[model samples]
Target: MSEPTAFLLAMLAIYTLPWLLWRAAGQRSWLPLVVVQIVGGVLAGPAVLGAVFPDAHGALFTPGVLGALGGIASWAVMLFVFVAGLELDLPDAWANRRDTATTAGLALIVPLLIGAATAALVMRDSVWMGVGAARWQFLLGVGLACAVTALPILLLFLERLGILRSPLGQRILRYASLDDLIVWALLAVILVDAEMLGRQAEFATLFALATIAARRLFARANERDRIPLALMWLLVVALGADWAGLHYMVGAFLAGSVLDSDWFGIPVIDEWRDRILTLLMPVFFLSTGLRTRWEMGGMDVIGVALALLAAIVVGKRFGVLLAARILGWAKGEARLIGWLLQTKALIMIIFANIMLDRGVISPTAFTALLLAAVLSTMLAMPMAQRAIAARDADKG
Candidate 1:
C-alpha cells in the first residue's frame, strides 16, 4: 500500500479502535476513554502488535508514515500542553492560600521524596538512567513524574462523580492547580542545559518581554482575533524554546501560561481543548507507545512499575492524611483528597515523554513510569467513589 494511504488507515484505526473497545466494554469502563486510548496505543505498538504481527505492523507504520505521525503527535501534544497552561487560575489558588499551599506542599513533597528514593534504588543497577544524564537529573526527573497530577483528567473524573462544582471538587482543583505550577517550574529547572545555557537565557529574556507585549495586545484585541493570535504566539514560543534547547513542549506551556483564558472566552477555549483532544491527541499516545521498550526485562519493568505505583499512592495518601490531621479536617477527607490528587494520566505521561526525549531516563524507565501512570489513573475513580460513599453512609 502507498505510504499516504497507510498513514490514513493508521489514523482511522487509531481514532476508531480505542472508542470501539471502550464501547465494547459496555461504555462504562472504569478507565476513561483517554486511558483506553493510551492502552490501545500500547496494544497497537511495536512491543505487542509489532512483535506479534511484524509484517502488518511494519507495513502500516513505515518510516514515512511514522515520520508523519511523529510530526502530528508533536503538534498535538504542544497544543494540549498549551491548553493546560492557559487553564491555570492562580488567583483562585492564592485566595485560598493556606489550604492550597498546605495541601499542595504535602502532596507534592512527600511523593517526590519517595519517588526520588525509588529512582535511587533503580539506578543502583546503572541500566535505568538515561544517556547523558547525571544521577541528580535522572533522580529529579523520575521523582517529579510521580508527583504530577493530571488536572484536566481530574476534572473529567470529578464531573463523572457529579461533584465538579462541589466544594470538594473546587478544593481539589486549587490543590492540583498550585501543584501543577510547581511541576512545570521544576521541569524547566531540570531541563536546563549547561552547554546551551546562553541560548536558554536569551529565550527567557525575550519571552519575558514578549509576554508583556502580548498580554497588552490580547487585552485590546477583539474576541474573533484572539484564537489566531494565540496560535501565532504558540508557534513563536515553541520555535524559540526548541532553538534554545529547552524543548518545544516547555515552550508550548510557557506560551499559553502568559495568556489569560478569560481573554479568549472560557467556553471557546474549553471547546477548543476538547476538540484538540478528540482529534489530535490519539496520535500522540500512539507515538508514545511506539517508544516503549522492555530492554531491562519485562519482569523487572513490571516490578519497578508496581513499586513506583505503591510509592506514589502511599506517599500521597500519607502526606494528605497528615495535612488533614494538622488542619483538623473532618474524617475521611484525606482519603478522598489523596486519591483524587494522586491521579496521574496525561500530564505525568507528558512529563515522562519530555524526560525520555532529553535522555534523562531510559526507555525502560519511561515504560515503567507509563505503566504506573495508567494503573494509578484507572484506580482513582473507583477508590474515590467508594471513599466518598462510605463518608456519606457514616454521615447518615
Candidate 2:
C-alpha cells in the first residue's frame, strides 16, 4: 500500500539473511537463530518502530496471527515430543532407570519450589500488571519455572557436549524424556485450570476416541504406516480439537506421549518423527521470539527483572543441584547436571500463552515473565556448558 510496509518487510528480510546463511553453513547451535527472531521482531515491533510505521498493515500483528503461530508452534513442539517418546527406547532407559529417574525428578521438582519462594519475596502490589494476576502469577510462575526446562534445547546441547551417547548422555536424554512427560502433564493441569482447556474429560474422551481409531489403523504398521499417514493422523485430530473448542496441543501431546510400543522398531516412524521435529521445530522457537516485546528494555522493567531472573537461574540451578546430590550423584556431576538440565525454551512461551489465553495474567506481566525468561536463557546455556565442561575435565 505504501513505502513503509514494504520497508518493514525488507527489514525482516535483512534480519533473516544471517539465519539462512548459518543454516547453509551447517551450524547446529541455535543461539544465532534465537537472537535473530527476537531482535528482528523487536526492531520491527510497535513499541520500538511503531512511530516509524504508525499503523502498518493492521492484520500483520493481529491476535489471529499470534494464535495461528501458536498453533503451528504447538504442532512443531508436539512433533518433538513424539520423537522424544520414540527415542525413549524404554528398554534402554529402564536399564539406566535409576539415574534417569533421579535426574528427571530433581529437575522438575527443585525449580518449582525455588520459583515459589522467589515469587513470594518480590511480588507484592500490582506493579501495574495487566494479566489479572495479583498473586496467581507467582504460583503459575513457580510451576513454569520448576517443571518447564527445554527438552529440545537439552537434546541439541547434549549432542554438542559429546555426552549425548555417553553413559551420562543416555541418562540425561532419558531423564529429559521423563521430565517432558511431567512437564506435559503439568501443562495440561494448568491449561485446564486456566480454561485454555475445558474439563479434563474433554481431553480424555477425545483421546479415547483417538486411541480406538489409532489401534484399528496402525495395528500392524510399518514404515508405510509411519509417514504421511501418521502426519495425517496428527493434523486431523488437532483440527478436530479446534472445531470442538478444545486445544489441539493437549491432543497432539497426548498422541505423542502414548506412542505405539513398536515406534522405535518401526524405522519409518522413527525417521519421519526425527526429520519433522528437527527441521520444523525451529519455526516454533522463531515464533516465540516474534511474540516477545523488546520495548520492555527500560527502568520500568528493572524491578521484576531481579526477582524473576534470580529465581529462574539461581533458584532453579541450585535446587536441581541439591536434589541431584541427595540422589547420590557426586557433587561435581550434580552441579553440572543441574546447569545442563535447566536450559529454558518452548515451555515458557507455551505456558505463558496459556495463561494469557485464559486471562490468568496481564499482557504486561506476560511481557515481564517473557523478559525474565529471555534473560534466563542467556544465563543458562553458557553456564550449563561451562559447568559440564569443567566436570568433564576433572574426570579426565
Candidate 3:
C-alpha cells in the first residue's frame, strides 16, 4: 500500500513476469503466457495499484523496450518463415494443384465475407471512434489476418495426432503450405501498397520490388552452395527494412515465400527450424508476454474480440474445409481441413503487438484481441486434436 513498497513491487514485476512466461512457454504453450503477462502487469502497476497515488508506479510496454522486442520478434519470424519454405512439396507440386487452389480460395474468401459483414453490422458504431480500427483498410487487415491460417500450427496439430504422413493429412498440409505462401505474397503487396498510398512513400514499393530482384540475383549467382551468404543477404533485407522505416516482418515474409520454392533442399530448412523454434522463438514470445497489458484494455472492445474469433475460427478453418469439399473431399477430410486450419499461434500475438504499437487499434482493442486469440487457440486445438485422433482411429 505504501509508495515505496508499490515501487519495489512494480520493479519486481518487470523481471518476475518475464521469468514466469519463460517457464510457461517452455511447456510448449506460450499462448497462456500472453494472458498471464497482461493480467500480471495490470495487477502490479498504476492502473489498478497506483490509483491511490497516481504517479507511484510505471508503464508496462515502454517504447524503447517495444522497439527492441520488435527487432527480436523479426528474427523469430525469419526463422519461422524459413521452415515454412521447407514444408512445401516442391517435387509433388503438380499432384496437389487442385488441393492448393481450393484451400487458398476457401481460406481467403469465406472469412473475408464474414469479417466485412461483421464489421458493418455487429461493430458498426466503432465503440470509441478513433480508439478502434477505422477505414476499409483496417477491415481488410482483419480479413487478411483471418484468411491466412498459420501452416505451422496446422503442421503441429497433424503431428500430434500422428497424421502428418497420412494421405488426407499430407494433402491438407500441401494446401496449407500453398495457401500460407500465397498469403505472404498478399500480405507483402498489401504492406507495400499501404506505404505507397497511405503514407505516400513514393519510393517504398519500387524499392521493395528491387530488393526482391536483387536478393534473387545474388541468390542465383552463388546458388545453394552459398546458403550462409544468402542468409546474410536475407538478414540485410530484414535489417534494411528496419532502417528504411518499414516493418521488418514484411521483408522476412517476402523472403520466406521467395525461398519457399525449395531453393536447395529440405535438410537446410529442417536444420534452421530445429535451432530457431527450440530456442529463439520462445524468448521472443516471452518478450511479447512482457509487453501485453490488460488493465487499460477492457470488455468495451467486444467488437475487436468478436472479430478475432470469427476470423480465426470461421474464416480460416471453414475456408479450408470448403476448399476440400469443392475438390470432392470426403466428410472426414473436410472436417480435418476445418480442424487443422484453425490452429493459430505466434503470429496473432505478433500482429496484435504491431497494430497496437502502430495505433491501428487501441490498447483496449489490442488487449481484447490478445485475449480472444488466446481463447481461440485454446478452444480450437483441443477440438482439432480430438477430431484428428478420431479420424486416425477410424482409419485403423
The C-alpha lDDT values of all candidates are 0.89, 0.59, 0.58
Clashes of each: 0, 5, 1
TM match of model 3 to true structure: 0.73
Tell me the lDDT of model 3 at 71: 67
In candidate 1, what residue range of length 10 has the lowest lDDT sum?
Answer: 119-128
Superior candidate under lDDT, 1 versus 2: 1
User: Over the stretch 201-221, how does candidate 2's per-residue lDDT look in tens digits?
Assistant: 565677788878786677667
Q: Quick one: best lDDT, which candidate?
A: 1
* TM-scores vs. true structure, each candidate: 0.97, 0.77, 0.73
The model with the greatest TM-score is 1
What is the per-residue lDDT of model 1 for residues 141-188, given as tens digits with 9 covering 90 to 100?
Answer: 888988889988887888888888898889998888788889888988
> What's the lDDT for residue 154 in model 1?
86
Model 1 TM-score is 0.97
Cα lDDT tens digits for candidate 3, 126-243: 5412243345645555555565555666666566667777886777677666666665555544444343454425335655676677657755765555567557656766665555
Cα miss at 105, model 2 (Å)?
2.2
